[model samples]
Target: MTIGELAKRSGLTQSRIRFYERIGLLTTVERRANGYRVYPPEALVILRVIAIAQSAGFSLDEIRTLLPDDRAHWDHDALTDTLRRKVADIDALALRLAQRRAQLVTLIDEIEARPDDIDCADNARRVLASLFDGD
Candidate 1:
């Protein structure tokens, strides 16, 4: 098939396909006498895998390391290790986010609990002190 046909089948733009080829993500394609590129049917599946890996938070550089040129050369152990590491990173991020959320909630409660007669500046000082003192 032609580059246009590959783009239609893979749901990627022609320029993106060309970019992938230039970046070594896509394998070299055959060219005809007219200098137009020709792609095999398997190119569609390769493009889909690249898209899915990106959606799963894999960077293009990481994806390059993960995906071998040929399926037979795939390293199962490396794939498993990389996925496990990503999960660990995600867990650590979740913990940090939870801590930040709790801190924000505490700040909001402190503001809401401020005395009606207190001035805004004093109330702000109290909140700042509480946050710094880890109250």
Candidate 2:
């Protein structure tokens, strides 16, 4: 297939495909006599892996390190370790997000309980000042 075909097949732009190649995220493709890129259909498999890895929160460098240099060189142990570390990182992030959600819920409750007959603007100013230690 050609670059255009690859782009359409991968749902990426031609420039993005070239950039991925330039940045070493993708292997350099062979060009034909007409100076147009000639991509193998298998390249789509690699591109799909790269896209899914990125969306899964893996960095470009991490993905590069995680993917096998070649299919024949695949290592199951290394893949397991990397995935384990990613799982730990995701767990930590989830815990922090839950804490943030709890704090937000408390703040909302406080706001909801604000005195209705009080001067709301002045009360808000005082609340903001106390919250942030402002003037």
Candidate 3:
């Protein structure tokens, strides 16, 4: 498959795919005689893994370290440590999300509780308070 076909199939931009290849985050891809990039079906799987890892807050540089080599072997201790670190990261994100949700809920409650004739000038203050008052 060509670069365009890989981008379409993997839901990534062609530039991003090429960027990964350039940075060695992706393995070497076969090039056509015409100099166009060609990808195998497995490349899509790797791309999806890259996307998920990124969403989980792993930087491309870090991901490169986690990437398996062509030999398909990894150090068990290192892999365990990486999983532990990722779990810690996810826990911190969950805490932040919970705090954000509480703040949003307070904002919604305040909006719902506002008096029918409340001064328009105070509405903005109420919202600001809801956001920063995180209790």
lDDT of each: 0.87, 0.83, 0.82
Cα displacement (Å) at residue 77, model 2 = 1.5
**Per-model TM values vs. the true structure:** 0.85, 0.82, 0.67
Global fold similarity of model 3 (TM-score):
0.67
Give per-residue CA lDDT, model 1, range 55-87, as digits (tens). Answer: 878899987887778855779899889888878
Model 3 regions more than 4 Å off? 96-135
lDDT of 2 by residue, 13-68 (tens): 99989988888767748878989889887788889988988898999899888777
Q: What is every candidate's alpha-carbon RMSD to the true fold?
A: 2.0, 3.2, 4.0
Candidate 2 off by > 4 Å: 121-135
Error of 3 at 110 (Å): 10
Better of 2 and 3 by TM-score: 2
Task: Supply candidate 3's per-residue lDDT for 100.
Answer: 95
Error of 1 at 12 (Å): 2.1
Which ranking of candidates, highest lDDT first? 1, 2, 3
lDDT: worst 10-residue window of model 1: 65-74
